[model samples]
Target chain A: MYQKSPTQEWTSNVVRYKKFSGSWAWLLHRITGLGLTAYILVHINTLASLQEGPEAFNAKMQVFMQPHWIFAAWILFGLVLYHTLNGIRIVIIDFGKGAKYHKQLLYGAVVIGLIVFLWMGYIMFFGHAEYDFLSMIVTSYN
Target chain B: MSYKYIGSRGSGSMSWFLQRISGIVLVFVMVGHFILMHYNPEMGHSFNRVFERMQNPYYQMLQIAFVVLALYHGLQGVWNIYRDFKFPSWLNMAVLAILIVVGVGFGALGIANILHF
Candidate 1:
């Protein structure tokens, strides 16, 4: 009798399976998908604060505009950017146009993501004095 | 006595198709939303600004549609991931039921908030 061992199965499924570009892309897609879904649920609840009136909602917004929270917001932005770009890649492949150049598409998505991220990051962190203005209004809205 | 359900396996393709459709819709709606919220923070982040926006029937409709599409896309993605785990049939059904309840609950709450204005 011959049988595969549990450790070997784990290695094959978990370790080696993640080595390729496609696998890495798949893994990142799954992570970003899950993260975005979780964010949507929380976002709805936060928006529901409007039922309590503007003060309540503004209070929540104040917390969200804090420096640490702003960093998290940037990370969330990056995740959505990556997911959206990769999603387009997936759609192109599904349309049967880029199956052979899938690897190139993945790399192309990453390069584009980086470029957009830098541009957005600069605006978010520097180009907008209005970011501060908005935070002030949110904090003082009550 | 025993019973079995027929054609339980046919939903996979339907879900796959729906996910892609919802993803395309989300890409447009979400990018619009992000630009509105971040690119124009002064107009988007103020309580008065949001209140004003929600007052418009068209804006409310857009928000409601966004919520519905997002919930469907997100819940479908989560369900697809769970399917890969090969859970037992009974547990799978339980998970699906829970996901449905949560998805519908959030969607209703979101729509109600939009309509509240």
Candidate 2:
């Protein structure tokens, strides 16, 4: 097997690292957006299953309550909170809310993102499993 | 010296405006969505109720519009971001082509689902 010399390998790694890190923020935003959208579709599909009858819907909800799904839900919530809060930051910055306070606001977003993420994580982890599905779909259903 | 902005005039600005407008609209849609899908005891966990709701023309049109704006805005944003990278033009074209196809495909399917109701 042809092998790269240590010097060549180092340079290649540095180039790759620079390319990736340069766009890391935007890349993360896009990835999380895609992930969140996919989750939304799945969520809608699951709710659509409610058409099947009470037992079938209950069974599906049970699967959703599995540990793995719970973990995935928490992660998804964190991504959403991060993306939404950061998006607000972007919009505010666009409106010139804080030119001198740009970095401060960026840092504030990070902190707030973490806080919102923790709140979501807590609800997913410890809150009662009582998210009303029908109410989410329509007021008439009530 | 005239630096022509890529989005000076065309569908780009129109799409941008549509995205923001639709995004604001989605907030209301989602509020109604959560109330009907999650809170209503009759519809909350019942699949039949959901189908019945989707059968309404107003709801279906709202869904179609939502899906269209989302795809247009999202794909355009993604494509613009990709321009920042220093890649071969061919590679860029390939990526853009795939994105366009996927966007249209998903948007079509989402609308189709609404129309099916």
Candidate 3:
């Protein structure tokens, strides 16, 4: 049987490392970050319809107003929520004393992320249909 | 002889620090964005609705900042992830250049959308 040399041991070990909470967290953070980045590019391009005029933009947006697109947006929001919460945890661990309690921070982040994700899901699916009081603060077009 | 892969780049302490700061700002802006876009789909999807909001110069400025920061943070993140692996320096430079182009290109489009209002 061939064996890795001492110099290559560290790299091999990391590549074949066991999965744990921290590993999962790191992987998920990267995954969601990449997905969100890709989505941003697509979002920017999609909104370019505005340059073609209101009818063009409205027609483009009309496609996304469908239930399927709404569902997709909800899932996208889930990724954003997870990424944001974990980002906060990363900041705490790096800038503050959260390393000692990093696991707990991950747990807290997951809990809060879930709550926000579900709440946003509700809003994307149901709350958007009617006039929301809080929405009025930012939304009012003649 | 065993082959060892030493990275060919400097320690990116500045980018590391900025990533955290930009991430923090993104969270706040994203929250407000979610409220405005998701809370009322019409406000998000309708050009007239967004036009009304974009009429405010401050709001337009905020949106431009959002685009720049988001692009920077996201592309910088891709570079960070790439750094984790041992790639040839040319590939690294190429990837970095491409990320810059994507950031600038999409950034212009996002700003255009806002300015079009």
- The prediction achieving the highest DockQ against the true structure is 3
Whose lDDT is greatest here?
3
After best superposition, candidate 1 residue B107: deviation in angstroms?
Answer: 0.6
lDDT of 3 by residue, B47-114 (tens): 88888888899999999999999999999999889888877766766787799899989998898888
A1-142 per-residue lDDT for model 1 (tens digits): 7777998888777865547898889889999999999999998998888888888888888887665676688899999999999898888788668789999999999999999888877766665875663465466665
Each candidate's TM vs. the true structure? 0.89, 0.62, 0.87
What C-alpha lDDT do the candidate models reach, one value each?
0.83, 0.60, 0.86
Taking all chains together, the TM-score of candidate 3 against the true structure is 0.87
Stretches > 4 Å off in candidate 2:
A1-27, A37-62, A129-142, B1-46
List residue ranges in candidate 3 displaced over 4 A. A2-16, A129-142, B1-7
Which digits, one per residue and each the tens of the lDDT, describe model 2 over residues A1-142? 9999999998998787754321454567678766766665555455554445658877786666555665676676667665665555555555567555656666787788788677655554454346433343355345
Ranking by lDDT: 3, 1, 2
For candidate 3, the iRMS in Å is 1.1
- What residue runs in model 1 are displaced by over 4 Å at the alpha carbon? A1-8, A132-142, B1-8
Please give the DockQ score of every candidate, comma-separated. 0.71, 0.23, 0.75
> For each prediction, how big is the interface RMSD?
1.0, 4.5, 1.1
